[model samples]
Target: MDLDRFTRQSETEWRVAPFGKMRVPAVIYATEDLIRDMDDKVFEQITNVAMLRGIQKAAFAMPDAHWGYGFPIGGVAAFDPDEGGVISAGGVGFDISCGMRSLHTGLTPDAIERHKSELADALYRSVPAGLGSTGKIHLDPLEMDAMLEGGARWAIERGYGRAEDLERIEEGGRMAGAEPGNVSDKAKKRQRKEMGTLGSGNHYLEVQRVTRILDQTSAAGFGLHEGDTLITIHCGSRGLGHQIGTEFLKKMAIAAAESGIELPDRELACAPINSPIGVLYLGAMRAAINCALANRQIITHLVRAAFARIFPDARLDLLYDVSHNTCKLEEHWLDGARKKLFVHRKGATRAFGPGHPELPESLRPIGQPVLIGGSMGTASYVLVGTSEGMGLAFGSACHGAGRRMSRHKAYKTWMGRQVIDELAQRGILIRSPSSRGVAEEAPGAYKEVSGVVDATDEAGLARKVARLEPVICIKG
Candidate 1:
């Protein structure tokens, strides 16, 4: 957090020169104020990531950078397999493929206000939320393996959503290279009834109103307009992802020790990309990604059903869905030649710029939609990837208004009832099973989301498109 420790590269760029054992420099993208407010642990963790084997370029942190397990929460790093690059469990975080999904309602705020309370109750009753929540669909061992391999596509085949939604999701709703055999029985058991459920802590299903458009062209391309109503779902693989991460971290640590790899931190446990353990972890991790995609797809079905009961004429269409956690094999041009690298993005979003072949044809000229979720009752923004961002931090950007304080601290600072009442006075409705969960996710616990988005835009990580304000939040 000390400014003296870094050399200023620009208004939003700060560099920490490589010191001992570091393979490259460490870079953080943030405004001066944002950096000053960060914890010192962010500095230590990012520097530790720089020392990891086969790291390409520099270890980079986003505007919302904060202290996390091994890499900083908003860390980005790429490594080449031929250079002995390692796959790390900590670098991908426990909630594999945690991400955001937005939908178009094709209605105005007036239409929602008429049935706001009823719609809120309908959604609350329809979608299972909070800790240890379970859904009606319980998958058997065979079905679980099928879901793990097929992802959202499996959900669609089961009548969860429309076929058109696949184009809007990452990996066409199904991640390849997933090996269900790599997933443990215990992990599969934990997820049997978790599909279509939003688990606790920072996950929610919210009805938001488009309040402003920053870029008319991009906003139109994304089907956004002021006064239009929208829905956004934020969640990921539930207990299954946690179990896989836990199991793999231990396996990787032992493998690393046996292989004579020196880790800067115990939490940075990893295995060589060619190693058996690493390959197994990737297979399991990819399955977890599919679980998350299928989970979100099922939730979208529930949301559509809930809306039909309230407004039969309402239409819900997929916009874009992107994950912030996981390590993915990708191709990037490094130094003058194209190279294959495995990019690890922990609490970071992939901001692929315009003209990238991976994007859908309709959005190719506009680039990928970068959904920035805010705390409950706060404003979320829609941003587009910029060409300039492709060369910065391996086409990665911040995930959200990173936590400014611990959840415990926030709970101690404000009571749940008081927070709910305050938000209600501002016309925002909050519905949740746990008042304690509401207290822990108090909006004040996070940094100003606008400021984080502004820094991201200034740093060329993404371009702002539109702003959305929460009208109804189903907290978990």
Candidate 2:
């Protein structure tokens, strides 16, 4: 936190030299105040990431970087498989491919204000939440396997969402090389009835209105405008992703031991890229990615159905859906050559620059939409990836306003009931099953999203396009 302890590269950037087995440097992008608020463990964890096998460049942390399970939540590191790179469960986190998706509503803020109460109640009733929640769709073993393989396409086939929606999602809603056989029965059981539900904790479906347009040109490209209504869904594959991560971490520890790979932290259990265990984990992780894609897609249909009930003429169009946690195989020109590398983005999002072939055609010129979800009762932002990101941090950016305090700490110090009432008084309608959760996710628990976005833009990770404020929030 002490700027004096780090080499001040810029007003919003700091560099820490290699220490304790680190193969490269660790760079953190944050303002002086932001860095001062950072948890000490983030620096330690990020430095450890630099020591990993086949690390091509420096280990970087975004402005929202915070202490997490293994890697710092906002950490980014790319490793070359050809150079004996390794995959760490800690690097991917438990919620594999957990991400945010935004949908545009063809209504103005005034239109939503007229029936806000009824709409909020309808949404709370329609969407399932809390721990152990289940929904109407229950999958059999065969169906589950197909769902894992098919991803969002499976849901569209089952009449959950429109077929055209797939194009707006990452990997077109399904990542290839997913092998359901690598997924355990226990994980399948956990996901059986979670389809079309908004699971608990930091996850929600919100009705929002665009409040500020930062870049009019890019905003037009993203179909966003001030006062236009939109919906943001934040959730993941539910218990299935957790089960898979838990099950694999145990296996990878043994694999790590057999390979004589010494990890700075036990939570960073990993295996070499060419190792049998690593291959299995990648296959299973890809399946979990599919699960998350399918889950969000089904939830999208539910949103459409809810809208149809109130406004028969209303149309909900997909903006973009991208994962925040996962390792991706992407080619980045490094050291004067195009090399395929395994880029691990734990609590980060891929901010592919303009002209990248993976971007949706409509967004090619503007670059990929990077949605940054805020904490409860705060504002989220829409940003676009910049080519500068490709050179600075492997096309990665912060996923959210990182928590300033842990959930446990927040619960112990704050009152959830008061937090909820205050937000409601401010015209933000919120519905949650647990008051404790409301306290844990109190807006004050996170860093200012504005600060995070500014740092991101200055750091060349992403450029702001629009800012959105919540009108209705269905908390998990």
Candidate 3:
């Protein structure tokens, strides 16, 4: 976190010149205050990522960067397969495809305020949350493999959501190249009953109200209006993703050793992209991505059902769904040529700029909606990806108001009951199975979200669109 360690390129950009086995320079995008508050480990981890073989451009950290396993959370790096590129399970984190999905309620905050409590209770009962949470749908072995391969498309086929929803999801709601055979039996078992459930730790389903429109053009494009209500789901692949990461990290470590790939840190265990182990990991990882997409799709169905019980006219339309975790093969302009690379984004969102072929036609003019979630009782923002961001860090932006304190420290500092009461006073209802979980996810435990968003915008990563405040939150 020492300012002297980096050369300031601008107020929102800092660079660490390549040194000590580094294949490229390291960059961090954050305001001075944000950077100063970051843990020193962020510097070390990002620099270590730069040392990895086949790393292109720089290992970059977002404004919300924080200490994490192997690469820093909010880290962005790309590797070239033809140049001995490697895939690190650690770079993707345990929560594969952990992401955000927002839905339009077509109702104003004033309209929902009267029934907020009833709506909150209905959603809490309908959507399972917290540790080891399970949903009504249970997948058998065969069905599980089908879900792994089909993703949200499978969920829709099973009557979970509408087909139109896929257009708003990344990869058309189904990540291709998923080899379910590579996913272990144990991992599938852990997720069998977990589909549609919000797993513990930083995951939640919130009813938010749009309070500010930062960019009128973008807000209109995203169908946002001040006072409009929105439901945002923040969760991931549940136990299955964690199981895959745990199983593969150890295997990758052995593979890294066997392949004689020198690692700057043991946690940075990786294998060449073309290696047998890497192929297996990628297959399993893609399956996990599908698992997450399917899970969210099911949750969306449950949310709509819950809303039906409260407001029969509510139309919970999908706005956008994007994942922050995963190593994806993407095409980017490198050295004036379009090249294919594997981009790893851990706690970072892909902010595709305007006119990208991958984006939905309706949204292409404005750009991808970069949904940034804040801790419970805090304000979240909607931003649009900038064309300039493509060249900056492979079109990536911060995932959220990154954690500033560990869960242990947070729990020790505040009682869950007290935190709940405080949020209640602010009119932000908190519903969770565990009081301890509430304490662990206190809003104060994270960096100021507005500051992080400002830095991201200033750095040309993403442009702010709308800001949302929580009306109710069902936490996990």
Which lDDT values do the candidates have, in the order given? Answer: 0.94, 0.89, 0.95
Best-to-worst order by lDDT is 3, 1, 2
Per-model TM against the reference: 0.99, 0.98, 0.99
lDDT: which candidate is best? 3
- How would you encode candidate 2's per-residue C-alpha lDDT over 146-249 as one tens digit per residue? 98999999989999888879889999888999999999999998888888788888899999999999999999999899999999999887888999999989
- Per-model clash counts, in order, read 0, 0, 0
Give the winner by TM-score: 2 or 3.
3
User: Residue 117: error of model 3 in Å?
Assistant: 0.5
Write candidate 3's Cα lDDT for 1-476 as tens digits. 79999999999999999999999999999999999999999999999999999999999999999999999999999999999999999999999999999999999777788998899899999999987667999999999999999999999999999999999999999999999999999999898889999988899999999999999999999999999999999999998999999999999998788878899999999988998998999999999999999999999999999999888998899999999999999999999999999999999999999999999898999999999999999999999999999999999999999887898999999999999999999999999999989999999998789999999999999999999999999998
What is the alpha-carbon lDDT for the whole of candidate 2?
Answer: 0.89
TM-score for candidate 3, please give it. Answer: 0.99
Show where candidate 2 strays beyond 4 Å: none
